[model samples]
Target: MLRAAAATHLRRHIITQRRRIATPESIRAVAVDPSGSLTPRAVDLATLRKTTGAPLRDLLNLDIGERTRRQRRACVLPRDKAVLLQLGGLTAVINADEALFFDNGGEERPRAALRRIGASVEFAFQHYKAPAFELAVLEAVLAEVSSSFQRRRDLYEPVVQKQLREASCEFDGFGVDGLHRLSAFDGALMSFEAETRQALQVLDELLASDEDMLGLLLSERRAGTSVDPERHGVVELLLEAYHRRLSAVAGDVAELRGKVQAATELGRVTIDLNRNNIIKFNLYLSMSAVGLAATTSIAGIFGMNLVSGIEEAPLAFGAVTAGSGLVGAAVVAGFHAAMRSQKSIEQRARHAADDREALTSLLANMATVENVFDDACRDLTRPAIAARLEAATGKKPSEREVEILFDIFDASHNDKISLREARSALHRGDAHPLIT
Candidate 1:
């Protein structure tokens, strides 16, 4: 009885465990026949393996739960004569004769994107009789991806422009509403930029893989393999055409990103300027309050019952009033003077620090020059001087500017500046120091 009871308990536990485990959703795939018929079907792991002839290791990468492993990639399985491509939300397995597309459904449906590919395939079959149907399908996929980017740009580009205009016009009035709007614009642009960059990266990988494959085909043909020139030419043309289109779209995205970044930076600087103004205003208000308090204290001292003989004098009230005004004015003037002194001190300190840094940089550059020339009297040409100045101070002076500066430093009209002359000119306060 005990053994039978234990067996029943074990069966119940197993049933509960099984019920708790969630099953993976089946992947929806479309089978594209060479004859140009589209058959939509549900595929499980086993079925997908049978259809693609991929190993279990490769099939395991298709697990939707393993997101880290599902990065965009092109896996060319020469053994199975197939190419597995994961482009954004769509994964495709293309064989010599047919292709299977698995759509990882999201907010953006793959069906809408695949519709273009389906139509193109049908048209190609009806007219061209499918000379290189697989390559054509790949080209259509690339076109759809490019179109998707263009559509996203169209949807957001106008809104971005409108926001930018509003921001520029209302920049002076950076109230709560303006700030909120700016934040919203920044957030939206950030999301769009990230998505576009990801798409561009995938497209780049695709192009690189395509190039490698084309190179391999050419090499094989060179090795006396019977490769079709027509197919090679078609593949090259399609890849090149889509590459240009995709590159143009990527450039547009990059330009938009740059504009958005610039706008955001400008907004930040404006906000900071306004904040500083508010701080200064508050400081002035505080100084005025201090002066007012001094006058109030004087009046309060006189209002007390304890008084000197001056209270009985005729001019006492006038004198007291005048004295209070002068004391208040003096207090405010003292505050102003102290603030000015503090500002002067800070300015001088900053200038001294900058001078120190410049001097250090100059010394380092002088050492470099000495080591390179092996003689302090070695004359450097105009280009050499420009290169050294750029390396030291990160400012690439123009040819004319360098030429003029070289003349000033050369001092001998020799069309060349010696290291000793350059050092001497930099030390003189009247001369324009290149290190600065």
Candidate 2:
């Protein structure tokens, strides 16, 4: 009887345990702020533990603002003899005027920017195989970007242009109803924004997949890398694609900067032209004064008491007056020419100086472009750069130089530097040719 009773008790205990859900041994939580205003007062962990009943877990530094990102980790503790880890951005407080809310860990992290531009990467990769391939990989990449932009233009151009043209010339925004109707941009811009997001997602996927293959590609970056050279030439193609893409984007950015500088140059040129016009007006005014004085001389002679029959013969009087006016005009013009000879040369010198200054500014911009080009090359074609340097400089570089060059190639330019540009830059800097 005792043995049967003990067996029943054990069974009952098992049943009770099975029916109750065991609470986790430790519970942890973290907070994220999208408001940017929630700068928490500095908390002394020890004091907090003493003042409040809450246990001290860990401290995290975070930045939260409009388009800002913050990451936090919860306390690590054993739960039911097992580790329990929770990773996400669920605890966040967002506020108005912020463009985005990044909590809940849904948004991609910082290192994934490359993923945002995948179409460009694929377009750049066509150069992995034979050099004799019909299409220039660079051109192919540019065409793709152009196609994408053109597609966007087709969708939004008409609407934007129309709105810009038809918008009430009244630029006021204080009115209640009219303010609401104010133009931020063409309504099509919003539509494009949505499409851009979808395109970005697609690009992100492509880049993500490319990154998965990075380890393999990196290892193959050694001499004569080939993955089925007869077929895909996977790594080579991918590298070329990236090169083209970076170059194209960089070129666009460069072109925009160039245009801005050009506009500034134009403004300066206009000022100079206005100055020249002023000088020309001054000469015209001086000539006009001489003609007036000459006419007055004829009038003075005609008014003399011994005028005789000059006034009676109108035709002779007119001829003599005209001849005097012509001679006076010639004298004025000669004086003007002499004055111009003295000062115009000086004006030319000043204009030349201005031109020199403008040229210097252009050189500075070009230098910046050179740096951008070097960076792109390092990122897209490090091996090619390294090989080129080795052939030219005879003085073998240490691993550091090679590393530095590769870094320079990537960090210098934001896009691809053309072979001509790269070579010229080297020559300008007193560096040897890559091949020579």
Best by lDDT: 1
Residue 419 deviation, candidate 1, in Å?
72
lDDT of 1 at 252: 72
lDDT of each: 0.57, 0.35
Q: List, residue by residue over 2-23, the lDDT tens digit for candidate 2.
A: 9999999999866643332132
Q: What value does the lDDT take at residue 304 in candidate 1?
A: 84
Error of 1 at 433 (Å): 68
In model 1, where do residues sit more than 4 Å from their true spots? 1-26, 62-79, 105-110, 180-233, 305-436
lDDT (Cα, 0-100) at 95 in candidate 2? 13
Off by over 4 Å in 2: 1-233, 248-250, 253-287, 303-436
| TM-score on alpha carbons, each prediction | 0.56, 0.23
Backbone clashes in model 1:
0
